[model samples]
Target: MISLPEDQPRRISEGERDAGVRRLQEAYAEGHLSHEEMDGLLQQALTAATHGQLARALASLPAEDAGTTSAIGAVSGRILRRGVWRVPRVLKVESALGRVQLDLSRAVFEHPVVDIELHLGTGRAKITVPRDAVVDIEGLRAGWKDTLYRPRRGAGSGGPTIRISGAMGMGRLKVRHARR
Candidate 1:
């Protein structure tokens, strides 16, 4: 039998279970697993009470690729990225004296988790996320204005998660989910 490290958790957490299910779904979407196989493995991941069961459910899957990181900087003009754009795993956005708008409703996300690190001097930022996206903005620090965000009820699960961080000086950050 295979043995795990002593520091490894025995019980499975909700986040871990959710991540396992996401990996299974992504594998199925990418044609790596058949429908029947995906369904069976998904059941195993869902009903897994221990970490060992969850690991077994996700065994034999393709490893995740090393996603890329990109940067966008604007000194005095507007920085807008809307429509169908490819999203990287880590995006660093810096603006000095204009508005920053990122509409990710129709964007193609390459990774399951996207991190947006904003370093704004005085420009406000507006981000429109996907309908099924889960957003986390705990690491953000607003100097003068509060972040405008409202979590909607009934948001579907197993979608890509967006993590927003960094410092916004004297500019408000507005985030909203897509309507359609």
Candidate 2:
């Protein structure tokens, strides 16, 4: 990082922001960020609404060599309207020394927003939006697990909303939710 002298103002470049994103993404992926924390940070980067935010994400993620990552999710109104969804749609349902089952599903919304519901059982779930579209989501998980969902507010006004329900061993649902 470069600091500005008292006599002058400091200047930041787009490269620096990219560096931040790299760092952030790596940290989160590497298990450094709890699900909730990761979701919050990801939302911040997506909701940046400016080059500064995008740059920050690029810079925060682990520094990668040139030709590293193809744009995973860049904001685009067109994709939002299309309501297309790709990989990382997983939900776990059980957790214990024995076994568990979690179900994950999706439905076309009246709008672009994408919602998510996760019934966590025995793993870490991951997904990314390939386009910059509205994102809306609510997740419920169970059994000594954490279910976190964070989307750029207003981004997924009508995108997608996910719900999860299940139990951990002893037959008690740890997480449950249903949207009318």
Worst 10 residues of 2 by lDDT: 73-82
Clashing pairs in 1: none
Model 2 — TM-score against the truth?
0.25
Number of the top TM-score candidate: 1
- Per-residue lDDT of candidate 2, residues 1-180 (tens digit): 665576343343233333344456668878767777767777666555555565554554554433211122222111111124342333232223232222212332232222333333344433333222332232343445443434443332223333233332222232222122
Candidate 2, residue 143: how far the Cα is off, in Å: 2.8
- Name the 10 consecutive residues with the lowest summed lDDT in model 1: 151-160
* lDDT comparing candidate 1 with the true structure: 0.89
For residues 1-180, write the lDDT of model 1, one tens digit per residue: 676687666785454577789889989999999999999999999999898999899987898775999999989799999999999999999999889999999999877778999999997899999987888898899999999999756654656788899999999999999997
lDDT (Cα atoms) of all candidates against the true structure: 0.89, 0.37
Q: Cα miss at 30, model 2 (Å)? A: 49
